[model samples]
Target: MTSSQIQVPAQEEGGATILEIGQQPDAWREVGGETDEGLARFLRGITERPGLRVILTGAGSSAFIGQIAAPALRRHLGCRVEPIATTDIVAAPRDHLEPDTPTLMVSFGRSGNSPESLATTALADELVTDIWHLVYTCDRTGELGRAHRDRANSRVVYLPERTNDTGFAMTSSLTSMLLSCLLTLGPAGRGNVEALAQAAEHVATLQPDIRALAQSGPQRIVYLGSGALAGLAQESALKLLELTAGVVVTYFDSPLGFRHGPKSVLDGCTLVVVYVSNDPYTRRYDLDIVAELRAQLSPDAVRVLSCEPIPQELGTATVLPGLAHLDDAQAALPYLVFAQYLALFTALEHGKTPDNPFPSGEVSRVVQGVTIHPISPSDLEAR
Candidate 1:
């Protein structure tokens, strides 16, 4: 019944989630190599303008993808880049937008059908005058990708169909879209595409070991990292919670911040997964926390995750191979696979269905019951 016992793609038990997670390397390669005419046209348009703001917005996991990429994007683009959640945009639009500033809102979504994705896009169009939109989505047929595919000023990057997942939790869909946007719109996208694609493919070999490690049967999981990896840590925590149907209590935090108060959560039943940074300065802090936790808790309670080899002082780790060659933002595409496998196998080990996760119908694949109320002028003024 566990993932290690069953052959993958069997579709008998946790197959959908497993296959989606397993095929992420291929999905990244598929989207990363493709050339995008829409993104090219958007780049051309941007060069002609001045002071165009780029806002990266999404909901849930998609929003975290923006948070992971925004810092690097700002450094590359040398323009104002902001990652705002769609919920915030719909709830209070006035505070985030400047009417005269020509803005390019880059929206990231897996299904592109989530109500807030389209709601925020539409709201931005109505509120801003000189506006352009770029949507990165796995589902080209979904509302967000479909509505503006042919728009004159809008650009849509539709990832390969294989990345459009059927599982309740997004695996390929999330990573593929994130990788696609970074490659299509970010710097060195043209030349470095092949190497980046290979980096993801090389990481596939780690799955078996990771699957075995995930079967250790920890009831409480904590994921920690810093900078962009911190966002990935949050996504990893959510992925496990969703797959286990909330049976496994999960938490995510930065290495330095974990000491302030979050450290108290660890016990014998806990597995603290620390995502160590590649930067020397940040890596010291990450290793320090891992050492601190290892000394305080059971030795098996702490695990380090990184693209680079674990420093000698950090002890044992789960390394995603060849990812260290890429930057942290690009490295996230491969590092994502480890946490995904952990969540998937852990789901099966706990007697939960990875595909549906919540058989009780408490949660659905696409989110529901979120009504985006219109922001009246008076409501904006009241704030």
Candidate 2:
């Protein structure tokens, strides 16, 4: 059965539910056997065009997806790959777009209804002579998908039906979209996709363990990642904060970048979660930070969760495996699931509803209260 097919038991009043969303990683196995030929075909069409400069754009969580995908695409495709927030693109098109450039824009959206999302796509068409769009969205009938229908240079990849999550926070949708992108651009002829999917499923089984750790102690959380994973770190931090309704003060930093200034944020109450890379060069930086933190941090006061096992020198209190060899985008699935588990546990600890943590009504699943401005003639002429 698919992950979505598994029913979550109802939670007792003012108590944590036995069904942990973080374990969705284990459900990835259901998708493992399937081949992503559609995504591969789409990538081939985009890459075949000469002089293609690719822009991966999105907003909020979707923007974080682009950030993680950018580095991997640049390294593997040997093409210029940039991850730009749709908000930024809409506000300053000239800064991100080139009029004469042949561009392939990859957009990610959950609802695909964000105002900036449609505006950014329109801006690309208006400013660039040769612009092609690849939209990855969970909602098939949403604005982004509908906008691409009659357009010759545009294609929309609706995520698996199961990915259309009803929950306020994105869970399954994020992983499916990120995995689709990895298969689209990753090394060809290697069946690591199945392995990656299996790993995700395995992590799902560890949700209970993750929740236990998250509920143990440490009110402050710090996430460290490098390269493409840096975006994953940010997303992870945001997920914990949002799901817990800011019950946990969270921070994210690049492994090396953390030492520069952000390391000061780590203290006795901090729980440091590190997404270690398989790449040796990047892993060294991640390990180094862990080493420094260990020396200064009291073992009882600070909690450390590493995605992979570190040497004895780093002294990680908890290690979760099955992340090695996976790309940062794909690795993010298990890590995200773990964060969700932590958030839920933390929320329950504070007597908050994991489903709707912000009982005060400050935030909505779909953001509200933003006014969009029309592009002016002066803006066009400047480009």
Which candidate leads the pack in lDDT? 1
Error of 2 at 46 (Å): 2.6
Q: State in Å the error of residue 82, model 2.
A: 0.7
TM-score of each: 0.92, 0.89
Candidate 1 residue lDDT tens string, 206-226: 666666767877889999988
Q: Candidate 1: worst 10 consecutive residues by lDDT? A: 3-12
Candidate 2 lDDT tens digits, 59-108: 88888888887887887788888999998998888888998988999999
**What are the runs in model 1 whose C-alpha is more than 4 Å off?**
1-12, 188-203
Q: What lDDT does model 1 reach?
A: 0.80
Residue pairs clashing in model 1 are none
